[model samples]
Target: MHIEKNILDNVNIWLTPTFDEKTQTEIKEMMTSSPKELEESFYKNLEFGTGGMRGVMGVGTNRINKYTLGKNTQGISDYMKTAFPGEELKVVIAYDCRHNSDTLAKVVADVFSANGIKVYLFSELRPTPELSFALKYLNCHAGIVLTASHNPPEYNGYKVYWQDGGQLVPPQDGEIIQVIEALTYDQINFKANENLIEYIDAKIDEAFVKSTIENASFDTPAEAKDNLNIVYTSLHGTSIKSIPDVLSKAGYSNVNIVPEQAIPDGNFPTVKSPNPEEPEALTMALALAEKLNADIVVGTDPDADRLGVAVRDNDGKMVLLNGNQTMVLMTAFLLEQWKKAGKITGTEFIGSTIVSTPMMLELASAYGIECKVGLTGFKWIAKMIKDFPNQKFIGGGEESFGFMVGDAVRDKDAVGATLLICEIAAQAKANGSSLYKELQNLYVDHGFYKEYLISLTKKGIEGANEIKQMMIDLREKPLKEINGQRVIMVEDYDNSTARNLFTDEIEELKIPKSNVLIYYLEDGTKICARPSGTEPKIKFYFSVNEPLDSIENAKEVENNLDQKIKNIIAEMQLQ
Candidate 1:
């Protein structure tokens, strides 16, 4: 058995009297029996990314354990004190259905309470959005949610939120990271001050559900609501309670739950990965929908922040719609309802990520509302809402199956999005159409946009280095053309600059600096390359669009766009 000096040093620290007996025993066993696992577990400390610190659950600094969470919580507590001196410090905490989520959440609460900060922890498992909502609804100084968000069962995470109900942004995220880095393991205060801890459940749930119902608008007849059969699966996550309750409250009685997935299980036994974006995750739901002859099938990820939808196509077959299509449908539905209700004031706007379909921007323009593009995360969209305090945030979504219907919660809310999507289906049925048909109508009016995503997963430290090198290669050697289409412009988000390749003009990008590069083609085609900040993966997003003259032309136009994406992928040697 061999070990690097740095790894051995870190391991020796864990074996000291400061660590728990269980953890020390595990480290000693790993050292004597599993040297490889020991090396991987203690090689490095998990750093905070755009979301937060997430890693495999184990007894190591590189893993998500009590010591790491306690250190981060203490840092947050210190920062809260510095940011709000002479004021009562309060924070909300929630967890999802993951292994050790509940236990980890209690540790977070203990650390916060030990620092004299008030903790409003959920009595049971809850979705990520509710934690964000509780942060603002309770007027807390900060909040934390224990979730890995659609990751494998072995992973867990800690997401920090601010008073604005959004994830920490800009200087705050950096400052908090500095505070955590400066602290040692022994410096963490893990003592629990039971007096400062309060269990919050029904009150916050009631408020969140009420707000969700208030945000829903349905112009369809009563029969439409009864006729729209919706099959919802929470992927064994937290939405099992709130999503159904909200739908029932909104007059949706034809909803069916996948009995297998309804029960909250930390292991997510029913699906290979609890992510609805994966087709396999929705397999059970789709089967149940077919058996019941349902109209729509919806699934939410483990934390209930992202949504995935399957709609009955024109051919009477159940087909899954990608994230962009779902976003387009929901965006169109909300805009139409607003116009009908006369709520489309000029002071309203929408938001999406730059990698998302550009049709969102076009749709907002048609409704006389501005659409803002941020970086890849929902936190940026929330930041947009915070930036435009005077403007009403109608709704926003991303290429990932995450959408926020209203401004009540600052994160991508699957609960509210599910309700609104069901409403869209019911209203479409009342208008002598289906959600699939309404999507076609949107294309007829707003042009047909198609989007595709290619994610190359690279694991471990070597994989992380490979992803970094991929980004560097793409940035240093810009693409001049793709599949015969001339590259018109290149936007380097890291440098905050956009270069017009044809005109040789450079302009400043007003968005925050990120490690992303986008290439614009002459025919309105776009290609984006971005590395995942939280995981060891690099993703490439492709979007292309063309005019749809009528419903009959949809299939042909869609096929053409699909082929175009395939051609671009082949030409770029992405496969």
Candidate 2:
């Protein structure tokens, strides 16, 4: 544990906080643990990395708590006052249904209020994108949303958004970290100026919904909306109000919220994980869809930014769509509608993360729109829009179910995504075409892009060390081949360079330094490997593309592609 002496001193002080007996008792138990364990826990401070603070909930400097949240907020308020000076800076605050999420939101509000910054705090739980939209709608200088997104039950986090409603990147991330590093435990003022903190409720919600509806492009009539029998679930988080209301107002009357998971509960009682990407998380939603013979089953994570969906195939069996498939459907739907609705003019653009499905580029290109790839986070998506105000952003998404629609918000928005998705579903239903069929058509028009994500979980301090070593080994000796194909290019995102292994040509990467490596084969196969920033897991993304001559061969090509992916995984020692 390479830790600063000042950081070490600070840990000791936090472990001995004079606030409550409960925290003191917990710290006593940790102090009495194995010497090595105690050292690992207290040695270093939790870093406010690229996306901000995300960690297990506990009583430590390396954990998410009122103190850390306070420090981060105070630093941010200070930065905002400097960045957007001569203006009365206000901030919009929202929280998911995570445990202590409301408490953390209030903590941030109080901290900001003490700084004499006006705070618009959501009265009830809300999705991440709503916080983003609220920031823009209220014309606030910045925003914060309390959510770890789809992290495990023990985890909670805070995502900082610039005035544009996207997460901070590059200079901003570094600048905020600098400001936070200057904050001591005593420097964070948790005391609130009651007058400066306003509890916002229905007025904002109504205005937000109105703005969403005005922005949305719906093609179906209210009479045809009932044809789209959609089964929706929040997975026991914060999407309940926003998603349903958005769909209803968009003229889709047949949307049904999953009974068991409709309500917000931080414990997420029904599912082992609250993430929609997990099949078990959608178990109840799937069964309900099956019983109701619904067109699709959609699930949103706790924060409601990332959306997952399943559609009924020709066989009448409900099929789960991976992140890439969902991206293709949504991106294609938006581009098609945006053009017909006169929204795709001038420097129209779309965005996606490099690790996301490449189908976005294929669709955007077909639409004559420029598609830009960002680093893994959605902040870059928002930043690009900010940089190019003349360009209209259609939509952007990652394969992990996070999608951003329009230029209104910078982050992945389940609120707007849900509304837009419902409209897409309604259009298909009106035309007697299901989303599943529409997806197959996209696969036919664009090359079928199949992607598989494999993650290896490594827990605790020793696990992190192992991950570091793995990256070191890969950097030292790169892979030569995978599944009988020559590795043509090696892209080391950490070094911000790509080397053509065969020709020995090198080029610069546009993104910041991150410990990620991607190998591109001669046949266009891509395999990306990187460790998760917020979780103790390393993920490998495998992508393969094959042309579909006709709809009949979709199954055969899919089968061959699946086997090919498995062979490549085994060759790379990832299986």
Which candidate achieves the best TM-score against the true structure?
Answer: 1
Off by over 4 Å in 2: 1-10, 15-22, 33-37, 342-346
Alpha-carbon lDDT, every model = 0.91, 0.83
lDDT of 2 by residue, 1-575 (tens): 34557645755677554334676566667656644445555656677554567888877677888887888999998898899888998998999888999998999999999999999999999878778888888899888989888888778998888877778777888988898998777788888998999898798788777777766656568766777788999998888868778777777788888888888888889988888888888899999998899888889999988888888887889989888888788889878887887877748988888798878888888988899987787788888899888787888888888887787767888778777777777778778877888888898999888999998999877889898888888889988988999999999999899999999999999877888999999988998988987788888999999999888888999998999999998877876
Q: How does candidate 1 score on lDDT? A: 0.91
lDDT of 1 by residue, 117-207 (tens): 9999999999999899889999998999999999999999999988899998988999988999898889889999999999999999999
Per-prediction backbone clash count: 0, 0
Score every model by TM-score. Answer: 0.98, 0.96
Candidate 2 clashing pairs?
Answer: none
Top-lDDT structure, candidate number: 1
